[model samples]
Structures are given as C-alpha cells and as structure tokens.
Target: MTTIPSIIEELDQLRPVSDVAGKVLSLLDDSGCGMSDLADIIRHEPALTANLLKLANSAYFGLPGKIGDAKQAIVYLGMTQVVDLILLVSCADTFKGSHSGYGLDRGALWESAICAAILANALSEKKGFKSTGLTFTGALLRDIGKVVIDQHVKSAMPQIMERVETQHISFMAAERQVLGVDHAQVGAMVAKRWHFPPLLQCIIRYYHTPLQADGCFTEASIVHLADAICRKMKISPGVDDSSYEEDERIAHSLGLNETVINGVIGEFSEKMEHVRTLFLAG
Candidate 1:
C-alpha cells in the first residue's frame, strides 16, 4: 500500500496551479500596475482576456454600458477589483474537479469554496478591512490542499467515517488519524509549493482555528465565519454535514449582531446567482 505520507511527498513535487498563478501574483506584487499594464498582462492570455471582458459586462457588475475591453473593465470595476478578478479566474482551474474522498461531487467543493470567498469578502468589508484582495483570494484557495488529499481519503473513507462517528472527532482530526496529516497541513505545504503569499498560506493553515493563530495578518476570524456560513448554505460538504455554529468571539470581535449576520446571509443568498455567474463565466 502506498502510505499517505509517501503519496503526499511525491505529490508535493507537482506544481499544480502554481506555475501560472505564480506569474499572476508576481505581476500584481507591487499593486501599482495600472489599467494598461494589467490589460497587457490579460491580453497575453487570449482566453483569459475574452473571459474578463465577458464577465465585466455580465449582470453581476451591472454597468450602464458594455465593457468591451480589459481597459474598460479596469475603468468600470477599478484596478483592485480587476486584479482580484484575474486571480479568481486563474485559480478556478485548480479546483474544477470532484473529490470523492471528501464526498464532494463535480463542482460541489468548488461551489463551497466560492461561497466561502464571497462571505469572506463581505465580512472583510463589514469589518472595515482594507484590501479584501488577499482575504478574498485566501478564502477562495483555502481548500486547495483538499484537491490533492481527497483521492487518498476517498479510498479510506470507511475508516475515517467510522472514527469520526465513534470518537466524535472533527473531520480534520479524523483525517490526521487515518492519513497521518490533515488538509490544513497539506494545504500549507501546497501553498508553499505554489509560492502563495505567506499570509495566505497561514490563512489556509489556520482557517479552521483562527483564535489559535499568532502572527501578523490575521483574517482567521473572517475565514472561520465564512466557512460556517457556507456550510449552513450547503455550499460544500462539511465533515459532519451539519449546520455551522457561530464563533461568538468572531462576531463580538467584529461587533456583529444577529441582525447584521442575518442581513449578510440574506444578501449572500440573494446575490449568489450573480456571484455564480461571475465565477462560471470566467
């Protein structure tokens, strides 16, 4: 039998989405790249450019006029949004499959991930966090490790589920017991391999337990809340597949009341189709 550790070690060498995504990150590193510069980069990839233009004119943005070009998109959507949209579009390929191990069918895991990213972005705005760029991208990519780990897990599903049922353990804990490493660690490893931003790596690693994190750039609370919200909406298949509980600290820290949380949830539910169009069209 191939041990999980060995499989992971071998898989670690695979760049997956890193090669292309790394270049995208590099181009946006300074964040000073203007519309023309960004347009030049988008034009380098014909398909990406086409998708960008299509999404810009989609109902999600609701511009009065059609956005026929990358430059027009930047003008209508702003540079930060344009850059974030590029990253979102480019990263979608990394997660366009099913993970039977986690019981996520085609696009199930991806849908949940997108919801998490959307909620994370909404929460960041509510909390007045500048630059939801990193937060949105980080939340979206948080489960990249699962893409790699799910196959091995699918093969060991029975044992993992039995342990979860018998011991009442978290899915991640069950995963660690059965596979010798959970998705969080595997995700961090994947993030490092992909040369993702350090803060993003941390966000991926500690998303399940934000309060335990200690360092700069803590969006742990945001990710935690977003994950809960997505699960409640059945966007992804959580291990237990139950409704998510509120992290009281997270809400308190953000000064969120029940009304506000409910309101955001309502908004998300209403706009989900629009958001879905943005991602799918890209």
Candidate 2:
C-alpha cells in the first residue's frame, strides 16, 4: 500500500495552498483569533482582499453599505466567513478546473462543495454547534481528493462503475477496491499536508464514512449527511450519485428526525441558491 507521506509529497508537488490561505487554515482551531489578527494577515494579499470584499458586499451579506477595507470586511463578515473566503481563495486555482476524475464537469465540483458546505453549516446550527467554522470548511473541501486523483479515477472509472453495478457498494468503496485509495483518503492527506486542524482532517478523511471516524463524529456525520442530501438534490457532481445511500440512522444519530432533516435540507437549498448566485456571478 502507498504510504500517506508519499501521497502528500506527490500532492505537494502538484501545488498546495497559498501562504495566506495556509495562515488562515492554521487558525481554524484557535479560539482567540480575533478580527484584527485575521485582517492583519489577509490585508497583505491584494487579490484576496479584493475578492473577500466583493463576496462580503455581495448579496450574501446584505450589508447596508460597501465594506471599505479588509478589517471592516472582517468585522462585518465575521471570522468564519473570512476564513472560508481565504480557504476558497487558496484552493480556487487548483479546484477551478473540471475534475473529470469524479465525473464532474467544469465547475461542478465547486458547486456541489459549496452546497454541501451550506448544508453542513445549517446542520451545525441545528445541533447547536458554536464553532461551525471548521465544519463548514471541512465540508467545502470534502472532495478535494477528487482534484488530486482525477486522472487515476478517470482511468479506473470503467472498472469502478462495473464494481458499483455488480455489487452493492459505494463509488468510494469501488474506488478503494480498484484504485487502492479513495478521494476521502487522498483529501485527508491533502488536508494534513496543509496542516489542517485535527477535526477538519478527520472530517475530510471520513466524510464518506462517518461511522468510521475515530473523533469529531458529529461534524463528520454532518458533512456525510449534507453531502448525501446535496447528492440527492442533484447538486453534487459525480457519476456515482447512487453511491450515497440515504441512511435515516445518520440523522437519528444526530438527534434529528426526518422532519428536521427535511427542513434543514429545504432551508439549505434556498440559502445555497443565493450563495451559488453570488459565487457564480463573480
């Protein structure tokens, strides 16, 4: 079996996160990372600052007036939003292309990622999770392995789909059986290479199999359910949407019944549409 370090080394050579985004992700677990701290770090990057301002000022924020500077934008946007933007800016270059590995067309992965992220954020709120920042970030980048392992997956898709069709297994499982590594595992290595927080790493690594996560089970489960919901809604980008089996037990484990789950999905769809509009408009 290929070691994790080897995968990380290969992925690092493929161009990792920007320095600015690395700094932002490092603060994912910090409790006292204030607005000024984030502002100080983000303001140095002109392109990041501009993009962050535009997003904050977009219909997403519904602010009364324009955000004048990075600090002001941080104030209005909150630390989590700023961090999410920074993460997006960091990975946008790599994730911008068509990730044919997962059968996603141009921009499809980003669309599904954002929608799952929005839904994860909503699920966190319903579960009364105070620090939903990492949850959202983890959800947003859940499929990053797809970008890293696109070609490998593309090459094996024929055999992979055959396995999926022949046996009652998930695309992820098929990927593991055929390719020896699934996107979740690759994504976890990618997250580790970037020094993502432990929970975030766990979520990225186990979003597809929340039951297998050793820790951060709730957040991982949230991402899993959110991803499944987005897949059902056709927002997810992949040829194996059927692989995301709907497990009511996942919701039950989170203390959420069917009604609550549906409500969260409904609200997530409405809010995600707005986020989609703003992001695509940019």
Candidate 1 error regions (>4 Å): 1-4, 10-15, 18-20, 27-36, 238-240, 243-246
Lowest lDDT 10-mer window, candidate 1? 238-247
Worst 10 residues of 2 by lDDT: 1-10
**Could you list the CA RMSD of all candidates, in the order they appear?**
2.5, 2.3
Note the clash tally of each candidate: 1, 0
TM-score of 2: 0.92
Candidate 2 regions with alpha-carbon error over 4 angstroms: 1-9
Highest lDDT model number = 2
Tell me the RMSD of model 2 versus the true structure.
Answer: 2.3
Global lDDT of model 1? 0.75
- Candidate 2 local distance difference test against the native: 0.80
- Number of the predicted model whose TM-score against the real structure is largest: 2
